[model samples]
Target: MVRLPLTPAEVARGQRLGALLRRARGERSMLDIALDAHVSPETLRKIESGRVATPAFPTIAAIADVLGLSLDAVWAEISRPEHDVTPAASAHTRPERLTA
Candidate 1:
């Protein structure tokens, strides 16, 4: 299939997703997390580095599971564009706070 180029918003969201995952992963080795998530280290690297701008849902779900992150939390994170990209702000903010 011919894929259209990603818009700026999509690319930005992907970067936010990557940053969130990297923070949630903390000091854990990427190899270990990738293995546990049943994905290749290269895939994890791409996602974490924001190179794979719109990863498949299953791929993201698997990695999020390994990182002990809930989908709600993940959405809450990447959905917010104006918030500061801190680990605490990204991983723990309430969705309502996005408007507050």
Candidate 2:
């Protein structure tokens, strides 16, 4: 299935997510994590560089599993601000439908 297009906000969030993951991966070669997650090192590199903005859930689950991160926590951390009531929330604020 074709993945939905990401809005500017989502792109920014993906960049932030990449940054966080990169930070968390300090000292560990990308190859190591890629091997552990059963993904290609290039895939990990794309993810960390925000080249692949919306990775599959199973792919993310695998990466998170290797990083010892919770799916909920990952979602919470990357959600857009409008999805939540908090002043600085990060919920998925964009509309679900695609615009022309």
Best by lDDT: 1
For each candidate in turn, the TM-score is 0.83, 0.71
Per-candidate Cα lDDT values, in order, are: 0.81, 0.70
CA lDDT of 85 in candidate 2?
35
Model 2 lDDT per residue over 10-57, tens place: 787787667656766778889999999999999889989999877777
lDDT tens per residue, model 1, 1-100: 9999999988888888899889889999999999999999999999989999899989988888788777778877787765655544446433442221
Clashing pairs in 2: 79-90, 79-91, 80-90, 80-91
lDDT of 1: 0.81
Give the 10-residue window scoring lowest on summed lDDT in candidate 2.
91-100
